[model samples]
Target: MTDEATQRLQDAEEHKKSYDGIMGAATEVGVPGALGLTMMFTSLVMANGVLLSILAGVAVYVLSHIIVKMFFSHH
Candidate 1:
């Protein structure tokens, strides 16, 4: 009984670890993609000139860069 409980806890911990890893990876990519798409859509709708388009592109790039840095994996 004690051994079974220990094994169950170990299994649960393993599952949780894998779940966290998957979610971490998903966020690292999904967040940037979502942000970039939103920026692009808004830029398309709001930008009416070359200068505004250029500014929107820069804004998208900077925001994506910041998100990547924050979510970057070291391992």
Candidate 2:
């Protein structure tokens, strides 16, 4: 094969590998981290009673989970 063709193939493989790595990392860490951050932010920003904050956080967490599942469900 020509050098140019070989270079293109190598670039494609590298791109795929990087893409897969990013996706795996996102799945393993990104989702839960984002959820936690969101819950914390909601609770803190509400600045209401502690019980109310906790309930609001739980509600936000559940609602977010449902929304994410509905939108991003696999097959």
Candidate 3:
């Protein structure tokens, strides 16, 4: 009975590890997928002028980085 319990515990741990791996993979894939979709939408919306679109994108990106850094520094 002790041996059986040990085996069962090991099996449960292996399953937990596999579940964590799958969740990690899903998180990796989902982030890029969402980013790609958002980029596509932004491109379509700003399709009138490439220069303006690029400038706006860069401005937003820089501002976001600054904001994030500012908030992060407080911690």
Candidate 4:
């Protein structure tokens, strides 16, 4: 019984590690800007800034592009 419990715990740990690995891979290869744009747009609208919102949106787009490129370049 004790041996079986230990094996179960080890199996759970291995499954967790595998899931993390898969997620890490997906994140590296996934789309870059949907969430960031959503957040930036929401904030801009909430704050009600015109010029600042434009600048913020542009900055987020550019930064997201650069970051995604840097990560996906290696793979």
State which candidate has the highest lDDT.
1
Candidate 3: lDDT over CA atoms? 0.62
TM-score of 4: 0.47
Q: In candidate 2, what are the lDDT values of residues 27-68, reduced to their tens digit?
A: 545664577567767777877767776666667666666665
User: Please, what are the lDDT tens digits per residue for candidate 4 over residues 1-75?
Assistant: 999999999999999999878866555433435645665687687895867776676677677767866865774
Candidate 3 per-residue lDDT over residues 10-69, each given as its tens digit = 999999999878865554444444544455458658674666655555555555555545
Candidate 3 — worst ten consecutive residues by lDDT sum?
27-36
TM-score, every prediction: 0.57, 0.53, 0.47, 0.47
Error of 1 at 37 (Å): 0.3
Give Cα-based local distance difference scores for all models.
Answer: 0.72, 0.71, 0.62, 0.70
Residue pairs with colliding backbones in model 1 are none
Give the per-residue lDDT digits (tens) of candidate 1, residues 1-75: 999999999999999999988877666656666666666667768756656755676677677767676756554
Q: Supply candidate 2's per-residue lDDT for 68.
A: 57
Candidate 1 deviant stretches above 4 angstroms: 48-62, 68-75
Model 1 residue 26 CA deviation in Å: 2.9
Error of 2 at 64 (Å): 9.5
Supply the TM-score for candidate 3.
0.47
